[model samples]
Target chain A: MSRVCVPRDAATLAVGADAVAGAIAERGVEVVRTGSRGLVWLEPMIEVETVAGRIAYGPVMAKDLPGLFEADFLNGGEHLLRLGRPEDHPWLAGQTRITFARCGILDPASLDDYRAHGGFKGLERAREIGPAATIAAVTDSGLRGRGGAGFPAGIKWRTVAEAPGETKYIVCNADEGDSGTFADRMIMEGDPFTLLEGMAIAAFAVGASKGYVYSRSEYPHANATFGAAIETARSAGVLSDFDVELRVGAGAYVCGEETALLESLEGKRGQVRAKPPLPAHQGLFGKPTVVNNVLTLATTPWVLAKGGEAYAALGVGRSRGTQPIQLAGNVRYPGVYEAPFGLTLGEIVNDIGGGTASGRPVKAVQCGGPLGAYFPPSLFDTVYDYEAFAARDGLIGHGGVVVFDDTVDMAAQARFAFQFCALESCGKCTPCRIGSVRGAETMQRVMDGVDTEANLALITDLCETLKFGSLCALGGFTPYPVMSAINHWPEDFHVVRDI
Target chain B: MTSLEPWRPERGEEIIAGLTRLDGAVLPMFHALQGAFGHVPKETVAMIAHALNLSRAEVFGALSFYHDFRHEPPGARLVKICRAESCQAMGGEAASRFLLADLGIDWGETTPDGAVTVEPVYCLGLCAVSPAALVDGQPLGRVDGMLLVEAARA
Candidate 1:
C-alpha cells in the first residue's frame, strides 16, 4: 500500500489542504496528513512514499485528484505538478534546517512520527548531560534570542536556574504580533511537538516545574494545533517534570513585549512594567521566571541534539546559527528560507526570492517587522547579522523580509510607521503616544507641500525623541522606517514640495 | 465566533466561579465570557465583578483596554482583511478599494442586513502568500476583491 501525504497546517488548509485530503481519502490509499514544508506556494503539496523517498506533487486541488490518480503519481510518475524530490528542489536544497528539520516532513501530532525524525533526541541528551551542561551547550552555541532583542538565551536560563525561589516558571512568548513574520506560526502549526519538547527541556534545564505558552488570539489554527501537541507530550511522559498552560492574548500588539505579555498572562491589561526586577528575577505572579521566544525555545531541542559547537559553527560573527528568514510581499519565492548569518540582503531577496512577483525591479526591502527600517537596493550588500543590520540602522528581527516594488510611495510608508506606533503604543510613556501623532501630522504637512524642508527636519527630530525616550521598542524603533525613508528615498519625501 | 444570542446568566456565573482560584482571573474570566457569549454583555460584567470580588468599574476599565474583547455581538459571518505592510506592497489597497466599493461598507462597518462584518487586521501571518484575508477565521491568500467577497460568502 502506498502512503500518500497532504499538509494539515493552517496555510495549506486555508488554500484547501483539507479538501485535497478529503479528495484523497476516497481513493482508499493509506493517506497520511503531514505538516507543511513552508513551500507555501506549492502547498496542498501531496507526497507519496516511493522506493527512492517521498515523491512530491503540488498546490493540488480537490478537482485535480482524478488526473493525479491517472498519472500514477503514487509511483512517482510524471505529471504537470510533480515537483520531483521536494528536498532536492533548488529553493529548499540550500537551507540549513537544524531547528525546522522535521517541520514539513513529519506528522506534527504523531509521537512515533516525531521520534522517527530525531524529535526527542535533544531532550534525551539534555537529560543525560544534566542542566548545567545543557545551558553550557546553548551558551557555547552563541544562541541569542530570535525574538528581536538578540540577548543571550543561555544567560537567561542560567539566571532562572540560579535565582532563589521556591517556584520558577518558563514562559514561551508566542505572541508573534510582528507583521511579515510567520516562522513562529509555521513551527507551531507544522511541528508542534518540537515546541512542546523544547519547552519541556527548558523547564528541566532551569529547574522550573511550570510553563506557559502566551500565544495571541489571532492564530486560532496555532492555538488548536499547539493545544493538541501539549496533550500528546503529556501522555507520552515527555512532560513528566514540566507542566504547561496555554494562555491566549486578546488583540493587543503591545502584548508581544515581554513585560506586557507577562501582564496579559496574569489576566490583566497588557501593560509594560518597570524593569530592574527582570523576568528571571521576578516574573509571572511575582515569581522567578525564564521568558523566551517560541523560536528561541524551539531551537533549543536542536542545539542539544546536535552539539553547541556544531550549531555554532554555521553562521558568521556573533550570529552563530541559521536564521529562519520568512520572505513575503512582492517576492516571487515567498516562503521560509533558513541560512547562516553572512548571506547578504541581495542573496536572500534577489537570488533566493527571485525578485518581485510583478517582475519589476525591487525598490526596497523591510528587513524586520513593522518597526524595521526600509532599505533601498544600494544597501543590498548588508549581511544578515545582528551587528551588521544594527550598523545599517536595521535589526535582523525574526528575519522577516517584506519586499516592495518600484511603485511604493516611501512618504506614505513613513506615515504608516508613525501611525502604527501611535495606534499600538502602550501609553505608559508620553514620547511614544504624543510623538507618533505629531510625527504623522508632520508627514502630512510634507505631503500637503507646506514648509517641506522644516517639516522634514521636524520628522527627523521627532524620530530621535521616540528612539531614545520611549519605554519599549514599539515606540523606540518607529524611527527605523521613518529615518531610512528620509535617508535613502528623499525623492519620495520631496512630494509636491514648492510646486 | 461572535454570536448574536444572549449568554446565560448561570453559565457566566459558572465561568467566574471556575476561574476564581487562579492567581489573576479577570482576563481569563473575560475570555470565558466572550467564548460562551459572543461578546461580553454589560450584565455579565457586573456578574464577573461580583463573583471575582473585583469592583465593576475596575472590570470595565480592564475590558476596554484590549481590542479583542468586544462590547457587542457581531453579524452572522465575520470578514477580516489584512491591511499590513506585506499586504500593502502587493496592491492590497487596490483590493481593499474594490471590496469597499462593491460591499458599500468601510473597514469596520457591518452590512445593513447583518450578513457580514468587515474589519481590518494587522497581519494574518500569511505574508508568504501575500494579499490575504480571513472569513470567519479561515484564511484566503493571493486574494483579490472577488476572492474576498467569495470568502465572506463562504
Candidate 2:
C-alpha cells in the first residue's frame, strides 16, 4: 500500500543510489523510480506516500536504510533523516516551477504517471487545434530558444513548418556540453515523456515524420532513460504520426551548436558549418529541419496546454516564460532553481544558493555555463534577462549559474577557460584553434608574473581575436571569462605580480 | 580504466549492419561499437566505411575528432575527473591534483600498475554536489582530495 519514490538521477546513482533503491524496495514497499526533484544535495531522496503526506528521507545511502526502517519510516515515522512534506520544504515552496513543474514529481518512463499529471495535454491541445494554430500559440507564448541564442521558438518552428519539404525533421539538441548546465539531462532522465511529447508535437507542427534526440554520451543515464522512453512511446503508439530516435555524441562540446550537431548527426566529425543556408532551409541530409534545445521543446507542451498569452504573462521584457536555472558549484544549496527571467544575479547567488559552501563571500558568479561572462559581486543586481545579460557582455546561457567564492583565483580560472577551449575546439577554424593555445599560454605568464603588465595586455589583445575571429561559441565565448576576470578581479591579476 | 573488449570482426560487422540503415548511420554505428566494446576498434573504420559507402579516412576522421572515442586500450579502471568551472569552484582542481599525485600518473595517462587511467572531463552535471568525478563511469559527488584518491585507488 506504500508508494515509495527514489530518484534514479545520475548524481543520485553515483552515490550508490540504485543499491539504496533496491534495498528500500526489498523492505516490502512498492518502489517507483522517479526523476530527481533537482534537490541534488539531498539525492537518492526517498519519499514514502503515507497517510499523513509524502514523508521525505533524503540523500539516503544504502547504509542509512536500516536506521530508516528501524525508525518505522514507512508509516511517516520520525527519524533524523526525515523531511516531511516535500512541498512544505522552503526550497520547493519558494519559486515558480512551470517548466519543471512535473520533474521529479512523476515516474519518468510511465506514460500513465505522466498522463495523470497534466502530461500530453499540450500534444492533445495541439492535435485538436491543428499545427497552424499550435504554431501560432507557441509564437504568442514568447518563448525564446533556451539554448543561448534566445531566438523565438515559435518563429523557428514556423520556418520548418512552412519550409518546402515533405521530409522535415525535428532535432532535439540534448547534447548539453555546457559545464554548469544540467537542465536538459534532468528533463530527459526525469520526465522523458514530456520531451518525447514535445518532440512529437514539434514533428506534427512541422509535418515531419522523423525526429532525433541528439543526447550527449556524457549522460549515459539520460541517453538510456530517453531510449527506453522512446521504446515505451513506440509501443504505446503515441508516435503514430511522427517517429523519434535517439542519437548520441562522442564527447564533442561543439556538437551542442545546431549546425555542428547536424554534422555529427550525419555520422561525421562535429565541425561548425557556415550559417545562412540555415538548418531550416537545408538540414539533416538536405531536408528542412527544426533544431531546438531540449528545454525549448519540452516547454512547448505547456505553452500549448495553457494558451501562449497565459505562459507569456510571467517574466519581464522580451524574455518570456520561466528559466530552470541550475544553482551549481560551491553554493551551499546546489540544485536546479526554476524562476522567471528577471531575478537578479545577487538574489540567485545569495538567496536561492545560500552562498558558498566554503562560507567565504561569493566573489563572482558565472551565468549561462562557461561561455557566459563572469559577474563580480558588484554586478549582483544584474537581471537574468537574455538582453540584459547581453548588454552586460554576459549571457543567460541555458540558465546555469556557477558560483565562486573568494578562494577562487580569477587568473587561473581565466587560463582554464582558454585551456578548455583549446582542448574542445573542433579544429576547423584558425583563430580558435591557434588563439586559444596562445591565450592559455599568456594567462600562465600572467599567473607566473612574467612581465605581468605586458602579458596581461597580450592576454587581453588575444582574447579579442578569439571573441570575434573564432568560428563558433566554443572559441568566440572563451574571451568572456578571460575578459571578465581581467575587468572584475584585476586585483587578483595584480597580486600575482607580488608573487 | 575499463578497456574495450577485444574486437570480434563478426560482432563489429553485425553492429555496423544493424545500424547502417538509420540516417547518419555512421555515428550510430561508432557509438554502438564503443558501447559494445569500450573503444571503437581500428578495424571498424574499414567495415563501417564499406557498409556506409564512406572512405576509411572519413571514418577515421570522425573517430579521432571526438574526445570520447578512445584509441588505445584503457586500464583496469577509468577515472574521469570534472575540471569545469563548477567543479573547480568546489575544489575540483585540488581533488584532481590529489588523485593524480596519489596515482602517480598525470592526466590522460595510465598508472604504472595499470590500476587506473585518468582523463579530465569538462563536466558530468553533478555540479550541485560539486567536485564530481567518475570512477568507471560511476559518479562520485562532493568529492575532496581524500575521496578522489580513494576513487582512483578503488
> For residues B1-154, could you state the per-residue lDDT of candidate 2 as single tens digits?
3445677999999989998778888888877887778778899899988998989999999889988887666778888888899998888888889888888889899988777899988888888878888888788888899988777775
Misplaced by over 4 Å in model 2 are A497-499, B1-4
Candidate 1 docking classification: medium
DockQ (C-alpha) of model 2? 0.80
lDDT of 1 at A367: 83
A203 Cα displacement, candidate 1 (Å): 1.1
Q: What is the lDDT of residue B132 in candidate 2?
A: 86
For A1-499, candidate 2 gives per-residue lDDT tens digits of: 8888988888888767799889987867889988888888888798999998788998788999899989989898899889889988899988788879999889997899999999999999999999999999999999999898889989998999889968899999998888888999899989999998899888888899999989887788898898999999999997686889899888888899999999999988999998788999899987899999999999999999999999899899999989999999888888998888899998999998899888999888988888788899899889889988899999998889999888888988888888888888888899898998988888888788788899988888888888888878989998988899899999888764445
Q: Listing candidates in order, what is each one's chain A TM-score?
A: 0.98, 0.97
lDDT against the true structure, per candidate, is 0.87, 0.88
**Each candidate's TM vs. the true structure?**
0.97, 0.97
- Distance from true location, Cα of A494 in model 1, Å: 1.3
